[model samples]
Structure formats: structure tokens, C-alpha cells
Target: MVEPAEFRSYYGRPILKEPAWKQPDVPLYLFLGGAAGASASIAALADVTGRPELARAGRLVASGGSIASVAALIHDLGKPTRFLHMLRVLKPTSPLSVGSWILSPFSGLAAVAAASELSGILPGAGRLAGAAAGLLGPAMCTYTAVLLSDTATPSWHEAYGTLPILFAGSALTSGAGAALLLVPSVETGPVVRAGLIGAAAELAAARHAETGLGLASEPYRTGRAGKLLKAARALTAAGAGLSLVARRNRAAGAAAGVAYLAAGLCTRFGVYAAGVESARDPKYVVVPQRERLRR
Candidate 1:
């Protein structure tokens, strides 16, 4: 068997640099962005299908979630006043810059949709805004993966293709969480099903990221990041399974909904932590890619 490569820290200090952003705001943005985007998609579906009430509710949730996500993103940036600097540069290679561009238009459309819905002042504007909101929603929901993937972190960069899908699934699950918390059982049932499917997909993506990525996935399989990933897998699986039977029991539905939400949060946190770890370990960055090149 080949011996695992050894790594040394820079100057005998820690190899990985600590993440500068606060935990709460970053995770909150992940949750809210997912929720908003999913809600908008659902709302568009409902509208096209002639379910006005469901459409309206979806629109409201999507709009609120998007607005909250934007705020959370700004808060997570240490220099809130300089957040706009992200927009000044159109660097396609920089996930942060790309995300800023995606977010600006999406947030504006969400605002218009929300205001039109609440004020009833714009004739036919609600429909147009809703359409625009729906378009931007998915962009907001999945771009976090790009943001993380663009970084120097080995684990995240290696899992770039899978991250967007995982984030999208998490977004759908979060939208279901909001619906379960706010909507009636009659309406929330389908949302719960949607959430379950999304959760399952997210879990599968994470697993694939871990196993298919080979050594790069070490950060997700060991230490603090590993623990969180394990927890996320367990919670998401349990929640998705339980949601299938939740229609028979209100308590089960509520529990599953809550579990899905928690699982989504955990998944995001774990991914973030894994990135930090991957960045810290030179072995993670150098060995795997080097091996790939050698092959």
C-alpha cells in the first residue's frame, strides 16, 4: 500500500487560515437563499397552474427569504460598507464577484414582486415581477457553491460540479421548512414531499463529493468537518424517510420538517468547515491534485 503523504504547517504554525466571516450570518444566508429561491420556483409553478393562493404564499416566502438572505450576506461581510466593491469588478473567475452580480438583479426583482403583491398598486406588475423573481430565485439559491468552489480550498474546489446541485437541494428543503412552519397541512404536504426529495439529493451529492473526489475529500471525512458531515447525512436521511409517512401524522410531519431544516443548516456549516480545513492542510491541496497530474 502507498504511504499517505505527510504535511508540514507554515512556520510551524497552523497551515489553514481561519475563516474571517462569522458563522451565524454565513449559515443564515445559505438557509434563506435556498428558501427564497425554492419558494419563488414553487410560486411560479402554482401561478401557472392557477392556484392563486399557493402562488401568492410562495411569492411572499420567496421575496422575504431573498431579502433576508441579502441582509445576512451583507452582515457576514466584515466590511459591510464596502460590500458594493464586490460589484465593481466583473471577474468571472471570482465566485464572489459572480455571486454579487447574480444577487443584485435577483434581489431587485424580488423586491418588486414583493412590493407589487403587498401594495396592489401596479397593474399586471405582480405577474411580471413574479416571473422575474422566479428566474432570479434559482440563481440566488445555487451560486453559493460557486462562491465556495472558486476559493483555494481543495475539498470545495474539487467538488465544484456537485456543490451547486447540493445547494439547490438544500434550497428546496428550506423552502419546504418555511411552508411547514407557516402554511396549513393541506398546503404543506406537497411542500414536505418536495423537501424530502431535495434533501435526499443533497445527501447523495455530499456522499459523492466525499467518495468520488478521493483524497481531496479527506477534510469532509475527518476531524470537526467530518463529524458535521456525518451528522448532516444522518439527519437528512432520517428527515426524508420520515416525511414519506408524515402525511399520516401531523407530529411526524412537523418533526420531519424541522429535521430537514436542521440538516440543511448542518450541511452548509459542514461544507464551510471542510473548506477551511482543506485550505489549512497543504497535503490536501498538493497531494491529490499532484497525483492526478502524475496519472
Candidate 2:
């Protein structure tokens, strides 16, 4: 059995420290950012294919989501005005740095696309803006995985490959949440279904990766992080299964959407928490890697 004392430091300090970051909001921002980016991409595709309604809705959601995501990110930074300091240099090893650069252009393009649609400005320009916005969407949605994976966090780095898929699923769920909140059940039904599929994919990938990761992965399956991961799995699975039958039921669809969103939030938070836990316990970083090398 895992004991609390086993996770303590030399001074009897809790070996697993809480992240300096606050909870809930940061993960929420990640979800929103992914959704916004994906929605923009989907909307651009619809526009190009002549699905005007889908295109319009996608663009609107994309714009709103992106803006909201940016706001959340800035707010979480504790100094919104100094956010630009993040872009002072380019560092390939740093996911946050790369993300800042990506966000700068992606957000601008998304804003332009949204504005062009609203103002009915230069029809030709709309196509260009839409296309650009759409292209950046997938990248925005999935890059968070890279950000977390680049860290020294054992749980995160050990599950590097799965992180991208997890982030993608979270992004899809965020978009589905927005769709359920804004669109009618009939129209948003497909979005919910898509989110379900994404969530399932995420859960499957995480589970498989976790099992193969050895001791470094233990934190993800134990303690507070473990509890959150279990909850996410349950909620996401239940929500996805229900989404199929809830296609025409507004209340059911709403509930499913909420569940997906919650699952996504829990996943990010759990991963973050697990990382903190792993970092505090030196054995997590040293033991596993050393064992692997000895093999």
C-alpha cells in the first residue's frame, strides 16, 4: 500500500507539491483554446465546401472560443498585462514559448475571420482568412500536449504520445459543449457524437500508455490524481455512450455535453496534479528511467 510518508521530502515536507498554478481555470482555458482552434478549422472546411450554416456557426464558435481561451490564459498568468513577455525569445524546447507564437498569429487570423463574416467585408478576403484560420485550428487544439510533455513532470513526459490525443479529445469536447449551449439539439447532435468519439479515443490512449509506462506512471493511477483520472474515465465513457441515444433529446444532449467538458477538465487537472506529485518524489524520476537504461 502507498503511504503518505513515502511521498514526503527530507524535511518531512509533502514530497508531492501542488503546482504553483491555480486549478480549474487553466484547464478550462486549455479546453476552450483547443475547441476554438478546431472549430475554426471545421468551419473553414465547411465554408470551402459550401455549407454556409455550418461554416457560419463554426467560425463564430471558433472566434468566441479562441478569444475566451486567450483571456483565460492571460488571467491565469497572474499578470495579464505582461503576457507579451512570453514571446521575448524563441525556444524550441519550450512548449509555452512555441504556443505563444502560435497563438499570436492564430488568434489574429481567427479574429479577422470572425470580423469579416460579421461585417460582410471583402468576400474574397473572407475565403483567405477562413482558410488560414482553419489551418491553424488543429495545431492550436493539439499543441498543449507538447507543452505539458516538454516539462520535467514524470506523468506527463512519460505519456508524451498520448497527450496529443488527449488534448485533441478535450478540444473536441469543448466545441461540443459550445454547440450544445448555443445550437438546437438537432443541429448539434453531430457535434456531440464527434466529441464522444474523441473522448473515447483519448481514454483508450491514456490507459494503454499508462500501463506500459512503469513506475513513473504510478502517480497517474494513485492519490488525488488517480481519483480524478478515474472520475474522468467514468464520466467520459458514460457521456459518450449516452450521446448516441440523446441525439434528439435536448436535456440528454446537454447533460452529455457537460459530462464531456467535465471529463476534459478533470483530465488536464489530473495530469497536472500527477506531475507535481511525481516531481516531489525523486524516486519517480530517477528510479524508472535508470531501470529502463539498465535493461
Candidate 3:
């Protein structure tokens, strides 16, 4: 028979510490990085296919997102100069350092490509820049997933195996969304395909993570995180369904693009919030460890 619980007295405080990330900035950075990475991929594709307008839009969005992501990081650090410290080392264990290195070149190349498109100068250089960004773009999106998981946060660490895949899918969705929104063309076959495939991948990965992650996945299905995740999933589903008709109806394409961007941002915020909650609650840590020991 189970005994009745009694209230215990102790100094009330969090048993675990929250991560050193700031609100709006870190999550914003994650969304922007994904958008930028996907833009770069689209830019490279457009360049190869002789679609100058599409290429221009992709380059500008990639450059803008890359620059904005850095600004958010600097703001989160509470000092513009503190960003320099992240560049001082290249440690394999430090995702910050690796991401800094990636973002710097990716930003510069993306900007140059966009500028060249506007000026109609240095076509060869622009192509080279676009090519480079294409290589770095996927890495930029996937690395942040690794960054969050390589921490003491249970919600993040347990889903490590699927986070990168999920983010990659999300990045493609945003990338395709940006193209649909800004490219000024109704021939969005590539965009639709990319978005549809990415949406499917994201849904599959997220569902699997939720189902298989056990206790660590609770935060993702409860409270603020749960609300955001639910909305994201709904938006992704609707956007994917609409993507099929994007080429026929520009308005539908635009709607799908907006939905995809919103969904991506929601996902970033949801995952970050869940990790923070897991970190702040000692039961998230202690109970998991205890259960592991029992097993």
C-alpha cells in the first residue's frame, strides 16, 4: 500500500541552473540561421539554373539573416565587443566558435553575392560566393542543434540524435518560404518540392523524438512549449498542403510562405523554452538519473 504524501520544509530554490542564453535573442538567432542557411542553398540552385531574380532574392535574404543572427548574439552577450572573444579559439567542443567561423564567411559571401546581383558586376565572383555559401549553409543550420544538445539540459541532450535532422528540415522550409515570398515568380516547382519534403521530414523527426524520448520529452508537450509546438505542427501541415498549389496561385504561395516562417520561429522558441524549463527544474534532472540507475 502507498503512504500519503506530506509537505516538507526546506529553503525553496532551483536545484539546477538555467543556461546563459537571453530571451528573444538566442531563439531569434536560431530561426534566422535556419532561414539564412536555406536561402544560401536556394541561391546556389538559382545561380545554376539561370534564374537571376530568384538568385538575387536568395542572396539578400541569406545575407540579411546571417547579419541579423550575429546582431542578436552580440546583444544577448550584453556587449558588442564580447563577440570577438568567440573568435579567439577554434575548439572542437565549442559550437559557438565553430558557428562563428561558419557565419563569418557565409555572411561575407552572401552579402557579396547579393551586392553583385544588384550591381551586375563581378559575375564570376558572385557565382563563387554563392557556391561557397551553399557549402556552408547546411552546416550553419545543423550546428545549432548540436550546440543545444551538448549541454546538461535533459530535453536537449536526449533528442540529440534527431535535432539536427529536424532542424535541417526546418531550414529548408524557411529557405523555400523566403523564395516563395520574395522571388517574384510563380514558377516555384523547386520551392514547393523543397518545402513539402522538409515539412514531412520535420514532422517525422519531431514526432519520433516526442514518442521515443520518454521523460525528457514532457516539456515539449506541456505548458508554453506545448502550445507553440502544437501551433507549429498545424502551420507546417497547412503550409505543406498549400505548397502543392503555390505555382498556380501566388496568393496561396505567399500564405504558405508566411506560415512556414512563423512555424520555424515557433519551433525554435518551443525547443529553447523546453530546455530552459528542464534546466530550472531539479526533478527533470534527478528523476531521470534515478530512473536510469533503476534500469
**All candidates: TM-score:** 0.88, 0.84, 0.95
Candidate 2 residues lying further than 4 Å off, grouped into runs, are 1-19, 122-124, 189-193
- Model 1 Cα lDDT, one tens digit per residue, 168-227: 988888777666655556656667778877887887898887788888887888888788
Tens digits of lDDT, candidate 2, 64-129: 877887888888887876678987888887788889888878888888888888889986787688
Q: Is candidate 1 or candidate 2 better by TM-score?
A: 1
In terms of lDDT, model 2 sits at 0.76
- For model 3, residues 1-295, the per-residue Cα lDDT tens digits are 8895332224756666788899999999999998999999888988889787777888889989999998998899999778888778888778877888888788889889878877889989988998899889999888899999888888999999988988998888988888888866455788889899899998888786667798888888888988888888998998898888888888988999998998899889988988988877777777778789999
lDDT of 2 at 164: 90
lDDT winner, 2 or 3: 3
Candidate 1, which segments miss by more than 4 Å at Cα?
Answer: 1-5, 13-19, 246-248
The residue ranges of model 3 lying beyond 4 angstroms of the native Cα positions read 1-10
Winner on lDDT (1 vs 3) = 3
Per-candidate clash tally: 1, 0, 0
lDDT scores in order: 0.78, 0.76, 0.86
